[model samples]
Structure formats: C-alpha cells, structure tokens
Target chain A: MKFTRRDFTAGLAVGITAPYVIGSARAQGATIKLGMCAPVTGPAAESGGYAVKGARIALEAVNKAGGILGKQAELIVEDDQTTNPGIVLAFSKLAAESDIVAFLGSIRSTQVHAMAPDVLKLGKPVMIGGTDPNLTHMGNQWLFRFRPNDSYSGRVIADYGFNTLGKKKWAVLHSTDAFGTAGGKALGAALEKLGSPAILDQGYANQSQDFTPVVLAIKQSGADILGSYFTYENDIGIFARQLRQLGVNIPWVGSPSITNITALKLAGPALYGTFGVADYAEESSEASKAFGKAYRDVVKVAPDNQSSWPYDAINVLAAAINKAGSTEPAKIREAILATRKFPGAEGEYNFDQNGDGLHGYNIVKNEKGTIVFDKHIEFTD
Target chain B: MNNPQFLLPNAVMDLVLQLLFTGIGIGAVYALVALGFVLIFRATNVVNFAQGEFSMVAAYLMVVFAVDLGWPYWLSFLLSLAGMALLGAIFNLGVYYPLRHRSFLPVIIATIGASILLANSVLAIYGPQPQVLEGWFETPGIQLGPVYLDSQYLLIIAVTIVMVAFNYWFFEHTMLGKKLQATSQDKEMASLLGISVSTMIMITFIYSAVLGGLAGILVAPVLFVSIQMGSTIALKAFAATIIGGFGDVAGAIIGGLALGIIETFGAAYISVPYKDGFAFLVLVLFLVFRPQGIFGERVAEKA
Candidate 1:
C-alpha cells in the first residue's frame, strides 16, 4: 500500500521504538539471575532473613562496583518454609526460570540434601552453607559449600572439649537427622582419635520442649564435658536450660546452633559459658565487623552465621561472574572454583573443586547470652 | 541381644526424676492445649486447627497487657482471656459461619489460612523473634521428700482440674449446656426449638478460645512466646485428640496425659531421638485399629 505523510511518521516512530525495546530486552539478558532458597517463615526464619540480608548487601556492593559481566545482578528469593519438601519445591521453581546462573543454598543440611539432586540436574553452581561434609562428596558436580563442613567443626569441637578443656569423659548429644547423625559420627571418630570416646552418645529429635531426660543421662554418664550437634535453636535452648537445671555443669561445646541468637535469646542466662565452633561472629574479623554494623543498622540485630555465609556467598558468586565475563553457568562455575583468598563476612574463602570453602571455624563463647568471639581455629583437611 | 539396662544409679535416678518432673511440668501445658482441642471438637464438628495459635495470641496479648501496658499479672491474664473470647466469637462470625455448610477440607484450609495470617500479622507487628513474658509467677520448687516439683507444675495441674470441672458442669448441669448439646447433636432440631444453634456455636468457640488462651498464658514461661511456636504444639495436640478419641472431652484429657507420660518415659528410658515420634506412632496405630478413637462411640451407617 502507498504510504501517506502521517503513515510515514508512524512507521518511523515504530521502527525507533522497536529497536529501543529490543535493545533494552537484550541488555537485560546480559544480567545474571541468581536464586536464593532460604527458610523465611519457620523456626530458622531469623537466620534465613539474615542470610538474605547478607546476600542483598553483597549484591548491592557488587552492583555498585560494576556488577557481574558489566550488567546488574538480580536475586530471586524463595522461602523454603523450613522443610525438605518445601526446599525441593523452591529449588525446582528456581531451576525452571532458566535464567538463574547460580543458586544460593540454605544453612540447613536437610534443605541442601533436598535441593541437591535438582542442582545436579540443572548443572548450575550452588554456594551452600550447609555443614554436612557428605553433601559435597555425594558426587553432585554443581554443589559448592561456602563454610567449613560439620566434619571440620566436629573435629574442632572434639579437640576443644577433650584437649583444651582437659576433660576426658564425654557425653555426645546430637539430633537424629542426617546432619546431626553425621556430625555425631565425625565427632565420635575425632574423640576416638584422641583415645577418649564418648561415654554416653545420645541423639534427640527437633522442637523438643524439655531435654531433662537427655541431660540427666549425660549427668549420670560421669562425663565431665558435653559435645552436641543440635539441629534446631529451640531444641538447643531447651537442652541448655534443662542441662543447667539438672546440675550438669560440665563444659559444653557444640555446633553452630549454640551461637544462634534465637537459641541464645530463648535460653537466656542458661547458655552462659557454652562454647561452639561458629562460621560467623560479629567480632571475628574486620569484614565481619563491618558487615555486622551494616546489618545491625538495617535489621536492628546482630548478624549470625546463617546471615553471614549467604552474604559472603553472593559476594563470591558476583566476583566469579565478573571474572567469567559472562552469565553462562559453566563460566560462572569456573570463576567460582577460581575463588582464592576472597575476604568475606564469613571469612577468607577458597572454593575447592568439590565446592567447599572457608576451611576454618571461630571458637565462640556465649557470655551472658551474647556470643563473644574468642579465637579462630583453622583446619587443613 | 539382651535387654539393655534401663534403670540408672541412685544419683542418676534422682536427676532423672527431676527431669521427669520437668517433662511433666511442660506436659501439663500440652494437656491444657489438647483439652481445648477436645472441648471444641466435642461441642462442634470443627477441628479448630487454630487452637495453638489461639493460645499463642492470648499469651502475647497477656504480655502486651501485663508488661507493655503495665497491668498486674492477674488483671492481664483476665483481660487477655476476655480478648481471646472476643477473638473466638469474631473468628466464628467471620470465618466458620460463612463456611459452616461447606466441606471439611475448605473449613480446614480456611483455618490454616487464618493461622498463617494471624502468625504473620503477629510477626509483622512484634517482629519475628522470641519475646519473654515478664512478671511470671515462677515459684521455686516445693520439696516433697526426694522429688522436687516446681510450684508452676502444681499451679498448672490445679488450674487444669478446675477448668475441666467447670467445663463438665457447664456442659452437664446448665440450660446453656443443654442447648449446646442440642446444637452439637442436631443443629436443625436445636434451631427449630428456638435454642439458637448459631449462638451456641459462637459460645462454644468463645469458651474453647478462652481455654486455649489460658493455656498459652500459663505455658508461656515454659515454652516462651514466639510466632512459630504454635504449629508444633498444635500438631501434637491434634495427635493427642485423635488418640484420645475425637470429640470426647475425657478422652482428650486421658490422651494428653498419656502422651505426656509416654513421651517423657520414652525420652528417659528408650530413645530421645524418637521421643517426639511416640505420639505420632500411637496416633497412626489408633487410626488403623480404632478409627472411632478410644472413647468415641461407633457410628451407624448413613441411610
């Protein structure tokens, strides 16, 4: 058809607008999308919120310094609802998006376990804070950890309980789930290496309101020290309260749950003098201090391991994406594995081939319900 | 393959008894919650999934009235109970009444939705963190020979007994009780007789909600008040109700106590890891073998 002056004007406008819209969409395509699966509503919500906050802070910092591959990064968050089934569904929804270059896993080993098969299927790198050592060795190529596994923490706890405290007899308490059982076994093996096995080894379930019987058993076992791997903050709080009420005043060394603010706040003075190997402590390092201050400014609360690790994971992932020069999964994986001497809020991390990093733990003490950073313990294995 | 030694030494026995007492103290709290579940289910066909959250909201309200608003413990407790009763009535009017004629699934889902909204609203206002209830009547343990029982345990048991007796009298002796029974049995007949079935249901909801609120206030010192605390206890109370016999008041009490003892003894003697599973195991077994529950009457086939 012949074009009039008005038709020609409209055609020019359409041509110009179409190219801008197409260019904008293509430009947006350069930005990498990352999915974060965290427990935002259940018992672990406190920690999960922190993790999200940490990730956001890291992402903002990365974007300010010129985002990954010169494009802005976006985080797509899904609440895991603090269950294995919920986590699996969340991961599947994230994986279906196709644009996500990497994934940020939850702090709970069970959540990671539920999401791992999907991660392997998707072939995208996942930075996780779950401490279960077997998560990495489970032959999942895309699974990478940002914190020292429970095996390392177990060794640290065992050594500190046995050698540092000079307590030979031990009572080991853990949850019956996979993470607890694995951590308990690792701790038992570590203690055995020192020629001092746990006198009374016990496993309990989560969300228990009373832990008196378990504490009494430990008290009766004649163990002068207590080693535990509690999977939930509430259970740990109850256990700590009952342990004190039963007059079992032995030195207690535990996993990261002992340092969680929820446990500390719930247990109150009951958790005083308790020790744990934590991934993050506000006083751990300069990076942690700065992060803690920033977090406190935003959330009006101190940062915990759950918050710090995800924060660091995002930073490390962003750094890798920038270095990779593309949002492609394989390239991002390469950049992540190449992470070396990266200072993060959690600690200096180096992602190994198996996707584990931060091969160290911070020895912390709960002083009158506040986590006091004591010292750092590094492991080579 | 021999039986493992279960008894502890004398010193350990003393410690174990103390721990058992502690469990019982908390068990009393569970019993109170389970009792609310039983009362409502017995009076109405509704399986109020919001019972635990009702308790939580009441407990938090007590904190607000007592601690923040600076009311005395007793006054705060009474005011919170009244507030809970009002909430119960409102919930019935707003939620259950609209969906009363619907299938059980919709009502159940509606309760779940209400629970989510209630919990999140609390979280949004109070923030998602645990808050300690101040001015608790945490009396020191009373020593009776070798066993030391906390005064809180005694208070819980005494309060539960009084509440149970009051509920029994209200359902058995009063005119309102007869109307409630009539409404529970056949709503059409009750309404035909001008007993006001809708009004009776509202009263039942209020009574149950008040009981749940009382339970929450009493147990707050033991379990602490957190937005997410309701779901766990609610599940346990559901299991307790099922095992005791759904819609049976006495069965609920028996079931709650039995669960408490079983869980306590199992944790002490058997496996602590499987302690919480004890209730579920019993619930499943009962569901398979005795679907009508321990105290429930067998129903005839519908015409």
Candidate 2:
C-alpha cells in the first residue's frame, strides 16, 4: 500500500483508463443505448407520438429478433417539443449521456438543420427522418436519412402532373420554413426542367390562419395545376378549405404531407382528389405492406411516413449495429452506408455515399377519404 | 387595403370587393379579441398577457365539450363560455387578487406567469393535436356576387357589429355600465361614491374572458383549435388596440379592422411573406408618428 514513484505512475494510468474500462462494464451491464429526439409536446406532438410508437414497435421487433451486439437494445427518448431549439436541447440532453452510441433525429427538415452542428460535434451516427436533400449532402456524415428526400418528391410531383395528369400552367405554394423553402425550390426546379414553369411561386409562413389571399392569387393566376409544399396539417386544412371555398379547384399535387393521415383528417373532404408524393405507401411493396400490418396491429391505425420512417430508422440502426457487431460510431456508419437492397417500410434501403437510404416516392391520392396508391417513381440519378 | 395594384381595371373592383369583405371578416375577429384586451386593460391598468390564452383555453374547452363529450353545438358554446367565466374568476382570485396592492411590474409579470401556466395546463390536459370544430352553419360559405363569403367569417362580422351596438348601449345607457366606468375611472372615488370597485373589476374580468372566449369559439372553425392559435390572433388584436388607441373600446375595434385590412391588402399588393410585418410596421409607424394612437387623445385622458 506504500506509495512509490513506479506505483504513482501506475495509479495515474489506472485513473486515466478506469473510466473507459468501467464505462464499458457499465455499458455491458445494461442494454445497448439509442437516444431519440422526439416531439413529445408542441405542434408536432401527435405525429411525434406516432413516431415514438413506431420506434418502440421496431424496438420490440429488434429485441424479439435478438438485439444489437448480443444485448437487448434500449431506446431513450427526449421531448424535442417539435421546435428547432427544442430538438437542439433534446439532442444535447441525449448527447450528455456518454453511453448512447447513436440517435434517431427529427422528421422535420428544419429541426434536423438546427441539430446538424451538434450531431457533427457528437460524432455519433444519427438516423434522421428529415428529407431535406442538403441534410445528407451537407458533408455531415453522422446523419443518415430514413425517408426519401424532397428532390424525389418534387420530381415525382412534376412528372406526374406533366406526363400523367397532362397539366401545364402551375402555381406552386409552399410554407416559408426551411423544409418548405427547400421543397418549393426543388419543385420549382423540377417543374422548370419539365418545361412547365410555375405561374405563381408563393411562399406563406406556416400555421397561417387564413389562406384567402393565397387562394385568390391562385385563382387569378389562371394556373390549371397546383403544386404545394405545406409544412403543417393545420395549414393544409385551412388552405384546402379556403381553396375550395374560393372556387379555385385546380388539379392539386402536393408534398408528402398532403396525403398523411393527419392532413387527411384535418382537411377531410377538402383534400379529396388531391395527389401527394408519399414516402410510405401500404401497397408500394411487400415491406411496406408488412410495416403497414405491423403498425396497424400495434397502433390501430394505418401507417404513414411519420410512423414508417422512425420504424425503418430503428430497424436500420439496430440492423447496422448488429451487422457491425459493435457500438463504435464509425463502424456503425460504415455498416449503414454499406446496406443495400435491404427491404424497408419506406422502400428498398440502398444507401448511397451520402447516407440517403431511399431515393423515390409513391404517388398516393385521397380517393374519398382513402389514401390509394397510384405508382412508385424511383430515381437512380 | 382595397388598392388597385396588379389586377385589370375591371377585375380590380371585384378584387377590392372581395378583399374588403375578407378584410372586414378578419378585422371583426381581431376586434372581438381586442375588446377583451381593452376591457381588461381598462379595468386593471396592467395588460393581461393571458388574454390570448383565455381564447385558447376556451377553444380547448369547446373541443372537450363539443367534440369529445359530443354535446350539442349551442350547449357546448354556452358551457365553454361558462368555463371561461369561471377561469376568469379563478385567474383574478389566484393571479390578480394577491398582487392587487403590488406595483404594475409585479402584476404584469404575474399575468405572464399565469399565461404560461394556463397554456401548459391545457397542453397537459388536451395534448398538442389541433382539433376541428365545425361552424354553426352547415353550408360552409356563400358566394355573394364576386365575393365568396366564408360562413364563419360572416358570423364573426355580424357578431362584431352586434357587440359594438350592444357595448354602446350598455356602456352609455345602463346604470351598471356607468358604475363600472366610474370604477375604472377612479377606484377610490368610485368606492367613495358607493360603487363596489372590487365587484366591478371582477365583472370586467368575466366580461373580458367571455369576450375572448366568444372570439375563440367563433374563429375555431376557421383557424382550427390549436394552442398557438389565440396568440396569433391576439398579437394582431394587440396591435389593433395600439393602433386604435389603447384602452378605448371604439379604438380597439377600429384599430383591429384597420390592421386586418392593411394586412390583407399588404399581402396582396406589397408582399405575402411580410404580411405580419405590415401589421407590426404599422404599429411601429404609429408608435413613431401617432404614439397616442388613433383614439388615445380623446375623452380628456380619462382615468
């Protein structure tokens, strides 16, 4: 027990290495930790609820299939409050825990953008549902998308409206938030490429109580086709109601939100006959069908992208961690990127170099309160 | 607001007509909520930041009664207003009464605290999903000539007009209103003159809550019942109060109408993204040029 020069050096070494060795022991004592930033309160709380349920369902399945690294997987969730600042705070709260190796990020692109810097600083792989193309493309290797980005949605919407619907003059309306702004620009660019430039390119702030001016503008523009990127279902509900009320019933094709269960319920009859580029469709594939059944059995409701992405995210993250046989961030990232032709609820998971898992959308219609799948549009380019 | 900008000469008139109707509809909504702010500000020198939350709470109450409990629309409306009236009383007792003798800063801070408490309480109870409350009318809207009038908007406008008329008659002619006015003018003097100042203040809170709740129920079908909905309406209504001259009943209505029209026309001609900016810009301009507000100078600075 006597202290000597060699003993002092040995004690210093033990002090330095103890936390790592003890931390590993502690990590091994419990299940594999996965942090999740979810919207437990605020505007997106309902969708956030669905997302949590999806992750939990996937967690159940993963545990049933023998979880990651021969240990049961654990999911730790923090309320993001569905705000940019909220997600940052939530992610930080999760990041504070040194044991959590990976994270499931927000479905909102803006929320993802807000948390991107922190994700990079954390240097842990985060499975995201944010579809902003720049999310993965922004040189942030830690972030991997579970859903198809807006680029595919924009192209699908434009292609369907032009080639299938046979509409030319278009009025594009979008929310002014990061997601909507990016989606609107993508849609605009896509339409331009299809030789059908938008007659009226309008961007309204989200949660708008009134859409009279927007409806009036669309009416006067004489646009036969409408392409929209609404952020919130409330806005969609209001806009659709006002659009119909104002008698501007142009053939409307919108982003994924248009055909979501939340939007469909809120907008009701007003949203009937509109088209949306959905990332998850029940009939799109067998994986999608299976996800639909699993979700419906657990959630007692039809599955949408909100629930589907998180479900796929948890499955993918767990699968990658298992494939790598480790919780090391770089190994998990490598495993995730190498994943190809993996059947997912969204679609086939073929991760490109940029960490995008899916690169296509299924066209869905609100046919008398039912989201009927139209066709799938996949892009290799 | 009905300015001719990008429309053809023929279409300009129609657009103006439509904008005017829509503006008035939206203006009436602001006016209704602004009246609550005015009533509370008139009675208590401190502005109740919870004034907006009053509408939100009422809307949620409506959802609970009407949608959740499946009560009749009229019964649910009455029950929701009743709930708001009770909340007003509780808010006064819990938040305002204790701080009654304190400085205006303490009281204002208390109201802000109360606002957060109210919003969080609702969030705890109802959750965050925005609920839909169908309008009083089965028919959604009516197309009157060139203008498509939303039924809810029309109902709001009519209610606002009736409220203005009723307020004029009640405040000018009724003995109770005169006594309440006296209490607002000078609580000490009114108390000396045999008016129960505390009772008058309580009535004012009740009326203000009822007014705000009414606005919420009316606009719920149009805006959809959400936590943030009231704050959005209340912001413009607050601007309306300032523009119309703070604490003046008439000024709040006129200011609300003006703000609504300016916003609509501004979004149309000027820029859509800056729609809210136009309202605050007008507020800033008023703060600069006419700081006393449109009606602030009148009534010899009473009370």
User: How well does chain B match by TM-score in each candidate?
Assistant: 0.91, 0.96
Give the lDDT of residue A324 in candidate 1: 84
For residues B11-114, write the lDDT of model 1, one tens digit per residue: 55665577567666666667778878876665566678888899889989987998789888988888999999999999888778899889767877888889
Of the candidates shown, which would achieve the greatest DockQ relative to the real structure? 1
At residue B105, what lDDT does model 2 achieve? 83
Error of 2 at A348 (Å): 0.6
Q: Write the per-residue lDDT of candidate 2 for residues A67-151, one digit (tens) a residue.
A: 8887888899999989999999999999999989899999999999999999999999999988788999989999999998999
- Give the docking tier of candidate 2: acceptable
The best candidate in terms of lDDT: 2
lDDT of 2 by residue, B1-303 (tens): 222466788787888788888888989999999999998888888788888899999999899999999999999999999999999998888888889998778988998999888888888888877889999999998988888888899999999999999999989999999988898778899999999988998999999999999999999999888888888998999999989988889999999999999998888777777788999999999989887789886423542
The complex in candidate 2 yields a DockQ of 0.37
DockQ score of each predicted structure, in the order shown = 0.45, 0.37
Root-mean-square deviation per candidate: 5.8, 7.2
Error of 1 at A304 (Å): 1.7
Ten consecutive residues with minimal summed lDDT in candidate 1 chain A?
A238-247
